[model samples]
Target: MSFSGWGYVWTAVMPLAVLLYYFFRKKYKDQHVASTMFWQELMKEIKASPYLKKLQHHILLYLQLAALLICVFALLGPHLTSEALEGNEFIFVVDTSATMLAGEPAAFELQQELMKEMATQTGGKPVTIVTTGANPEIVLRKEPNREALETAIDRLAVTYENAKIEQTILFAETLIDDESTVIHVFTDALDRSILANKAGMAYEIHGIDQPLQNVSMRQFGLAKTEDGIRAIVQLVNETAEPVSGKVILTDGEVEKTANIQLEAEEELLVPFEQLPDSPVWQAVLQVKDDYTADNSMAAFVQEASTRVAVDSSLHELVGAGFRSLNVEVDLMDPMQLRKAGGSPLVTNQTDLLAGQMPILLIGRNDEKTHRVAGAIETVPHALFTYAPFDGIYISEIYPPFEEYETIATIDGEPLIQLSPEGDIAVLTDIQLTDWPLHPSFPLFLWSAIGELSGTDNFFGFFQPNEQRAVALASTRGEWEIYKDGEFFYSYIEGQGAFSAPQEPGIYEVVGEGKTLKMIVQLSNEEKTLVQGTSYRIGQAEETAETAELSIVPWLLFAVVFLLLVEWEVYRRGNAHR
Candidate 1:
């Protein structure tokens, strides 16, 4: 037994004071009796039952003492030690992924309630909370305050990204030490085998395993048409029953609706033709479903307005690539330009127009030829999105330039390089490389034109919580980002990167006098709400102080009962007298 507040032990003096008062209280004075015969009879009766008279005289004193003692015990805050409270350190791993929002009340909402209940019962034990999303975050660490724990649990929210549950669990395990810790995982889809394999860990999985029905837009794209543009949308029914709904495509001004029906687990492609040109278009799925994160998607379209002046020997190929993207191309002869003293925007003749315009230099200074030796390494950049350097044979290349950033390299030789001024320099001679024969050649030229002309006609699409470095045409000042027409975040010029919002919507980046639209959508994994399994691992070792059962209420109840008995005895004694 333990007492929380020992200061209340001084209250034990109350019972002693009551005993002293009973022994030294003022004595009653003898009064002259008018009826001597009745007095004499009462005295004879008292002598006949002396033991009963003594018991009646001391009963009130005993009752008063008992009540005082019990009150003191109650104030001391006594508690019984139990084995159930051994592992007082608790770790809560919460999954904040989008799938937790699939159910009616939402698995996340239920998890919050459960956490609050368990936390309240911890009796001021230390608790840690970890939330999982695109990245795992420790929100609360070893906090013993009940109010702080409740506040942290209430503040938890669901992210639209997929949860990294396995990683988060491993991270939580790192916090365990010599102390016995109990870990509770709250998630929507955790595999039972994961916990079962954790042999010596004391943990429990609280998972929500309900059948979820959902319909999602698998993909959305736009294609250039003779009149305007066409919208291609693919929809999927993720349920076991047939589903039908209307798909509404809108550009904030014009709205087009299409009704469609699908069998269970079916995918259908629906195209809308002759739609007027718009900067952005959105598609909304109007199906009754558990998961709504994937029901809506947005697409951004930008018309090509970049004009390229090509003077390279491969102008025919380059011009063909530019024209295909609806970009105007002006082809110029190298000899005619040299004779007329005309500067070329793009050329293999580096001496003709050096440092004059944003140029795409093909084989500028090839003084020496080096054969490819080992594996080729390419840096991640916007230029290599569709144009990878795989299977491209390079026999000769110019020496690496210190002023340019190398994009692709063979062994130690630079193959593709880009300057800070947006000039793309291909060190390898195109005649000696077979990259031009590949289908990615035109795509490479398209990227090059966009980079040189400082025009970004490409649309940016990303999954929720995804972050990437953004390359804008003007990299000069702070860029402001807006989501759904509201300001979201901002970043500086050189450090131009931003993370997608937790919700699915369209984001606009405004900077350097230009605006670009980016779309954040739900990934396929988030859309498919898989049922999870729950498991309990090893048990917590029993300890003497594992739990505490407070006896204050019981003690106080005894005090109340004793006081009532003392009051009744005093009232009866007075009435008899």
Candidate 2:
């Protein structure tokens, strides 16, 4: 407890008025007009004071004194120094996710305002500006200039992906000071999971006012169907009001627009009867709104005529082998396939023309067969091939064979080596002389086919030379790993994915002896410039806890206490009246 102005204690003199009132209070004696009994009682009741009247109303005197004491304290400017231990190092977390774009003026607007307020409150203390989203990034570290911080805040843009608040919080925690540090999080209330590890520091949450009206295209994809290409699009109307829009689809030349209406908080499913046969097309929702990013999307449809053309013998042999071994294959002849097809495949012309598949050309001795085989490869399928009879008297090599993968031979010759998706089991330049006569020929062929046909075994599960830790939750008591429908390994409950086979391939994870269905694919889009967002901080709500003592202003409480005492004193002085 302290006083801002000790000299103002002189103001305490005004409370002495209570003493003066006690001294000057009027005294009266009753005169007996007719009743002698009343006169004698009044004479006996008269009390004597040396220099003042006896205003011995204890409660009123105490109350008056208290009110005057309060006034003097207010005038003296008394203040309490709490001596709270606060960290000097500051971490400023700002949310920049797609959901922040909702509402009028947007939730990010409040984020901008908070950045300024935080700057003022921080009093030029060093601050690290952390942008939160799917990929939480640190824009500036330990910045002192408020202007520079404000500029960074205004320049911040919303991420298309959702924010990963938990990971960001963990990252910020790493930078917290051991002594005293504050973690100020500015965001629309996302999720509270991010608060799990906030043990060491103080946290100030600045929540944004977000608008609820929004319509978003949540999911969209194109899948091949028996009738034609099947297109599925999903939309969610997040707004309370009803929403209506036209879904515009275009495959460059051909365009189809469908009207759609979605109730608030409702999901709408739009299915295309016939998908466009173009290689590069776009799906757009023509809804009028401020946010245009989620309104439209671009897609690359696989080619139709493009295929992995195999010789009749190899096709029959490999197709039967794969079926027997449960290797999935879509077997069809290019010429015959087009004639019997119900709808065309491969619609995006810019990316891949119709009727094209990435080809895996095998041994073709004749020119006619070679042309037939080369035509199936897509024009730009990133080609690699090997020859069985290069030294033999074969007339013309195929034209597209110019763009093939090769290596220098021992004789300084360019021998084509096979490296399909980096699997080493298949060697490309197998000579015809070695095919029927070599001792290792049968083993080599079996290995080559197995390696070529088999997809990357460790693709979805593990990266090359990477040891990743994974925790899988299952309802069953036990879990198992499977590759190509064969059992690999099993583990007890609460066991991590570390002990499972490190080799990567599509692994079917089964729980409790029942197959838990999930598919993992090698994501080429993972390297794109845009990263996904994550939700870390959650919404704030009133909890069933007592009010914080720190929130009450002591000066205001003192003033109220004084007023109560003053009221008692005033009432006592007026007793005679």
Candidate 3:
């Protein structure tokens, strides 16, 4: 037992002295009775029952003295402690990673429970709670509000991001000026080197101390084939031993099952051939693992559906290239087609030149009037991914502009140029130039079609960036955002862009009869669950003081009960008299 305000303890002596003085005083009253003999007889009866009579006379005195003692003790503010807080400060580092979602109680839950226990043990000392999330944050700071600390712990939640443990530890160290202050970390066993960086720091690690052997689908993809789409799923056994599992692949209402056996630390790729036109495919692993976050994965097979309007004289090889690249081309005379983002016009027809959209003007076949000239290719382009640009020859020259980006040059002329407006790509006549026979012929066209198509630029995920600019086809009056199928917030429709959410998950932009999907995923390192690896980095020689609860409140309650008992005794005695 300890007294926080021991200076007031000496005041108890004043009340004690008063009680003694009153007890020693004489009590007398002058009264005229009917008979002195009756009074004498009553006194003799009181003496016969001395125990009951004495208690009645002394009850008030005892009550007053007990109350005075309690008041003094209360003023002193006493408490119990097994160990002293030498520095009078503690820092709690919590891990909020996807891996913390594992284990029976979950590592995050266990960390919260430990924080609650520590809060109860605190002797009004300063405490701070920090979370090692993708963006590390200090949930609670140096304050003695026990309730607030508990509330902070209750609010702690796991994130899909990996634990930025080292950065968080370094931050905690900055808050510690006293050598005796202890830093308590609540996390898994993965990273502990941060503790060792500090030569002499008082630190203790409280880990979840459990292992979760997991089978995860690291990657899932789909490739377009001649017959249909091919689905590929990659499974990894993140364990020390071999594991057996069943993979259940679902395409719409159709289902397929395959048994898999993986050796220690093995990775297996399973492919399903000839899938239907299902836009989304799901692969689930039927295995009992400690962590279930990565047990199932979703992959989409979005085939390129470019609307390429080609002239009747267009070579059959051009159509074959579009098909090989999964492009859905519409064979029609260029004169009958209207240009759009998804629709690229490919024709030598001179009648289609009067449209508003930028034209991909192809030169007339004049081998005698024009000569092949060396060409220059543009740097930093998306179309260069699948094909190499050697050079293309042009027989006829067209007007060149500084506002256009040359994709390929024809005999010192613009063979293929992207207009600064970003809606045009022009090429010279392939019949007059030997460019069609080049090895990168089909690949270049396939890539060019992707650049022209608006679908190719839709962002897959919103990560590592807070803001993004979107090119909406039509900017209407109202646009709204949805999170996990529920309406979240509204944005001005004319803004044509949206800010990324702070939390990780799938978000959707819906309005004007069109919907766009965006995903946000955390760092992959945090998703990998490596259990049973928690330990302290630095060990201090000094022993930490264990906190013990004070019984002062219970003692005060007893004093109240005693006072009530005394009140009843005095009341009953007066009634009898």
Candidate 4:
């Protein structure tokens, strides 16, 4: 209990003085009466009331006095505090996660105890309630009203997601201005990664003392099949100690359980056999550990299909790669020709899509039908030329060309240049015909592959990035995709196929079937973890408080209102008599 308006204490004396004056005030009497006996009766009644009936007879008097007392108290606005209520600023963060629900007295119970501590230490200091979970929420902020602050604390609940402590800290940073603020955080220690980035503001950490030993179904995957279902389950040992657990797979009445052993920080994979054909299945990883939410994963499985196309010339290699990668690739011809039915390139048109144009033309003079041969000209897509291609041995040529510069003189010539008009021609002054048999055969292969394939200049085994779809089939009816243990996406029966249009990730198509796993190797930045190992707090501020009712004032008002009603009743009774 605390007072807000202590300066009004002297005004309280006025009400007391008024009460004293009323007590000693002189009264007038009427002489005429049916009998002095009746008057005597009244006097006797007053005396009896002084003994036992006094309170009952003069309830109105008590009411009037109460109203006056309440008004004085309200004007004084006095506040009382125990030794516990002496903090400058009360800052409390409550951990609201499923893990909090597991401990002895329960996480919420522990939070209540802490809340009491905060309430006691509040005195007249403003209190703030910060809720921690997947998304941090500010339940209260700098509210000097104690009852309202306590109600907000009581309303806090736990969530299935983990706490984002760093975000809460950042939020606190913005809430507080002076360093004198006392901040208290209450939570079960989750992944320290959440705290990797923080504003340097220091605060006290009150860990809800509990050791979490959990074995969760970290991942589950399924692939669609026409006749039966196939699935894969991964169990992770989230505990510090090595633990063994049983994994059960069931579709309603049917069930299968497998025993598994996992070292600390390691995981175990349990594959499911042909399961009964069903649209949905539930898998439970039963852990001997303390917590259970992290123990099981439920997924709905469904059937789907897809198609993947691959170029013909890369069949043997692509086939092997697909088998290793577990993706089906259909062989097809290259789409680089002028038309689907057109013959391959001729000598002057070595670039597959170059048409009849030369790559490069170098002369002070200009020629008709040729685009330009200078740096100023924008060359055609397939035509890249250079001046002086007279001596070079080009072996194993995919498209024969009439003009090519010798490899030995490339330093002095344009080498392989693009003409201003978009023609691909090499300088012809150097001499060396058997360049393919030279030590640069591999380098030549790289260059030839780049020219033949209409892909970007990156000459690797994998096709240059062109958006294309790939289909995967499974004996099971559903599947999940994961990259490095983190969930990406999933597919179920009737959903068709799970298509990835992005760069690359080492994907695990976990679920039913013999083909239980596949890896997608992406060399692009879109799929890479560019920021996982690093974090920075860009902005952190204490959250602003929403408009809320202050219970202290309301409670005081209720007491005042009741007193006033009693006072009105007393005055009316005195007048009627």
Candidate 5:
């Protein structure tokens, strides 16, 4: 048995003080007239003896000593020892990341079975279960029934999102109420150092020791060519052994196949030519690998619409920017464009245009100018990623537009703005500002074309469990999301953003008379099949035939009872005297 309050054991010597008082205690009494001579004789006899007297068999003395002994025992904080598990509460932390889905029987399945076995051995101890993912979740909480634990274990599933095991473990640690609780972690990528830093937390880490082999599609895209669309596929072998596979490319109707071999941990880029026109293309790798989640990938092929129409006075400058990026430019007069109604138009006029397509407004044609001097502030947007407004001077600026999102501001005045309809308006003229002389001018124009053409925001690739704002033409109706041609969920209007599925695949978001396709893939860290470090931490030094149970409360109760009995014995003895 262990004592939590061993320092208090020194209080056991307190009973020695009571014993000394009893041994040297003196008695006094008043007597009648004849007692002086007899008292003198008795005092002389007492003076001849030692100052310390022997202990007598008095009930009060025995009772006081017994009470002190019980108090000393209580102070020592005794505990009972039994042969069983130490803790009364068990907490299980399980990882649900994509890597757990590898191996023949799968690491997640093995973790489930192991957890259930340990839970059964707990002998009806309260158990809490937590899962790790992009967001950690507590699936079960403080359940004592064995049947409930098995049910919760059987319902456990794995996700394709990246693992946040350390965060989840810390989250679980907050729920512990005492030191008797034991935490059990089951994961494939948990670092041992994460648990070591916990100091005094009792936990055991269970890791999967099985071998894993996987080949993933790192990148897949399509580009329009002179003859037809071209498919680009990049594959990486995550295992240590060489692998051979057949890459199959399909456009829903036509199929193209290519055979390739890759060395250990090698990456290969394969290209497919002369593919028929299709809205979506899919690539599948037919190989024997443990993980199948990353074997196939789908992408929406961009339409042949890399053409921009310019009707601004600076048409030559805008045309030069588009042509530099291999994009065709069509120059048109402002009067002609007003009458022709062409889409994706670029003009400098402030008046409303005829077409409903996206437009890039350079600036107003007014002759007025305003001098600006201060640090420029830019909003966090995709346009500012490559084209920053640093080292540029603006001598003229226009009034800020209230209906547009201000991208850049100087002294709280809007300089660059974007409308909800995907149109961009540069409030200052290039000739009036020295920005055109800077390198950011061409990059700004390139990004502006992509924004107006719906190439950067409408549809693209995303990572698993990623949340992105929905850039739709209209946000007034319910949106439907589908995965692999099956309806998955419905999104309400004005929600503004949507989280991608935890699994990797192609998803389509349909709403407001628009259909947008997005491809979700696993992260680079999740793609590699490296085994994580694992070991137990803060485990108690327990014997095979002993489990400790605190008995301090019972000892305290005995001390209280003994003090009451001693008080009663002293009161009764004094009443008789």
Candidate 6:
């Protein structure tokens, strides 16, 4: 509503003069019509007065007058004043982190609306856009054209990655020059980023201070049950009061629901019984909160069979323990296991290595006969998971005879050793320690089987940002990790490892006539929704909200379009005459 050239208002009077001339100008008289028959020929012979035409209810005069007024208005340009034109150069750090996806429009979604409003108010000013995804990116940098800017903004998407706002700010700092350039961040909070000691731009955090009520699905999995599979899910309520909701389990074909009630800040484990048969499973909470990204999750399940050959001599103890568990075990001839291929060999002697697949040599001698007095020192290994044997006694032990890796030791002697392929040999009978009777006995055996049997598919899931060794289903062929059915990375079957994707979702890998499904999910760290106070980096200054937006050019275009219409109307009217 403001004008840049108000002092030139006196010039608009020039168009009014033309309007006055059209209304009061003298008119031309018609020649005396001697005969009515000759009047038609006389109209074609005599030219109409160009300067003094009859103006009684004439359309041309009105059209001319309107065109003159438009010229006057175009001279006085007009445009709406908006708050976005505050800076000559702007750098926007928009947080697209998982926490922003909490409300009806999502904090990030509202942030996008705010950004669009700023763009509309840009008045053609340059803007640089930054997104805080897993990897900070400069979506649009110093863009001045409004159409192109809008296109870039439209392409922006919500990311399930953790907040990389600090990194994004670092990237944005490079775009800023002086104290006048403003950096506005739109996110759930300002302090959620690692901004305590980082040095950079003098930015203000424009975030939603209201804490969104969120119930998060921290983790979930499926365990074998007597009747069927049981779905185990860990949930937490981030609100100030107790929340009541249901957890739905689905396999794309069938569905089941389990209701949950949790107090504020309370963590609970809920299990759903009797799962249906499905390769793919999804767990979704029924809680309706501001944040819903963590409300639902997907997982894939794969099962494997384990076969072990236990010598007839130790069959009374070791063989009985294996049968007591659900896994398969054989007490027959060792040759049958060797020819069967891929099955592990469990014997009291190391010479059983003739088979070459994978071996677990359990010492045959009883520990009670040759008791060793020294306490053993064991290193951390997957076999020790849930199995604590720190003070267990070992009497007779066959120290590692080869250069294979030693897994554990007693005083200065090696107690157990293993090869890269999980060919392990316990120098003493496992029954010698309290581990067999311990609850971790089954877990220990399962761990050994998973490694030695080369289980094709992973049994569980991983957090998006977590890194661990991923075992391939087979060692004979190369394996490739894929995202959305396209190749992303490749891994050697022998090495059997690749970094997990940093975005929360499901992924798959294929090789050796088998496919493996894996789930990479967001960590617990991203579920926090508290906002942070605004701070600065280099120097602080006030923000601007107005810029020069003139509509004179657009107005002139309208004037030209109107004039074209006037010309067309006059031409058609004269032709009819």
Candidate No. with top lDDT: 1
Candidates ranked by TM-score, best first? 3, 1, 6, 5, 4, 2
Can you write out model 5's per-residue Cα lDDT over 1-577, one digit (the tens) per residue? 6666779888877888867766677776575546788879877876776443334447666667776787777677777755554466778988888888888798899889988877756656688999987678898999987789999999988877888788888899898976778888898766676766788668888887667888988778887789888889999987899999899998668889999899998999999988887768889999989988778888777532577888746636667777886777778887766653434677777664325767888876543557777667897665765677997888778765678888788867888888877688888777767776777777777767767765542466677777755433343557788876799888764464667777787678877676777777787677667675556677544313344556777777776787788888788888998
lDDT of 6: 0.69
Model 6 worst lDDT window (10 residues) = 364-373
User: Per-residue CA lDDT of candidate 1, range 247-357, in tens?
Assistant: 999998999999999999999999999998986899998988988878888876643336777774763666776678677777777765444321226677666435456
Per-residue accuracy of model 6 over 1-577 as CA lDDT, tens digit each: 7676666678788777876776567767668988888897777554454334444547766777777777777666666676554556788888777787777767776777778777777768688888885557888878888778878877887666777677777778777775667778888777634656645445567778665788899878776667877778889888899999899888767989877899989999988888865666888888878877788777655434456776665546676666666667777664454454556667765556655767777773323224465776766555664344665666666546567688677777777788665577777776566656665566556666666664445534666545454433343546677877778777664353456766666777777676777777776767666754554544435656565667787778877887898899889998999
Tens digits of per-residue lDDT for model 4 on 466-557? Answer: 22222323345466766557886676633642444122222455664332333222222111111111122222234223222224565477
Off by over 4 Å in 2: 1-87, 133-136, 159-162, 209-211, 223-230, 274-276, 288-292, 303-577
lDDT of 6 at 312: 65
- The lDDT-based order of candidates, best leading, equals 1, 5, 6, 3, 2, 4
* Residue 354 shift from truth in candidate 1, angstroms: 18
> If scored against the real structure, what TM-score would every candidate get?
0.64, 0.44, 0.64, 0.46, 0.58, 0.62
lDDT (Cα, tens digit) per residue for candidate 3, span 283-379: 7788877877667666556533356766556777667766776767677654466643436666654444445543444543222234545655654
Error of 3 at 519 (Å): 3.5
Alpha carbon lDDT at 156, candidate 1? 93
TM-score of 1: 0.64
Per-model clash counts, in order, read 3, 38, 3, 53, 0, 5
Candidate 2 accuracy as lDDT: 0.50
In candidate 5, which residue pairs get closer than 3 Å at backbone N, Cα or C atoms, i.e. clash? none
Better of 2 and 5 by lDDT: 5
Root mean square deviation (Cα) for candidate 1: 11.6
